[model samples]
Target: ENKPITLLELPTSIASNTILTLLKLITYNVIFAK
Candidate 1:
């Protein structure tokens, strides 16, 4: 799902990056939180 985002806006870019990070953390937790 790594589409090319037009991150010309700084806050938008930061928010998206933060969301991606959170998603990764959640996925990891789901797998390891057994």
Candidate 2:
């Protein structure tokens, strides 16, 4: 059914979004750390 397609697509998109969020947080921290 749709399960296989969802399994293949959701992880990569979710991972990328999570990574981008983490990177943004890190960048902001660095900028404000001074």
Candidate 3:
């Protein structure tokens, strides 16, 4: 079902995207803080 597919695949994509976004944010903060 759609729910199962979303639960399995969505989280992986979302997690990676979230991690990348967080990394970018942190990098920006570090660069601007200096």
Candidate 1 runs further than 4 Å off: 1-8
lDDT-based ranking: 2, 3, 1
lDDT of 1 by residue, 1-34 (tens): 9767575776798988999999999999999999
Model 2 scores a TM of: 0.77
Ordered list by TM-score, greatest first: 2, 3, 1
Best by TM-score: 2
For every model shown, what is its TM-score relative to the native structure? Answer: 0.73, 0.77, 0.73
RMSD of 3: 4.0
Name the runs in model 2 displaced over 4 angstroms.
Answer: 1-5
Off by over 4 Å in 3: 1-6
lDDT of 3 at 18: 99
- Tens-place lDDT per residue, model 2, 1-34, is 4556577788998999999999999999999998
TM-score of 3: 0.73
| Candidate 3 local lDDT, 1-34, one digit each (tens) | 3555566788898999999999999999999999
lDDT (C-alpha, whole model) for all candidates: 0.89, 0.90, 0.90
Q: For model 1, what is the alpha-carbon lDDT of residue 21?
A: 100
State the TM-score for model 1.
Answer: 0.73
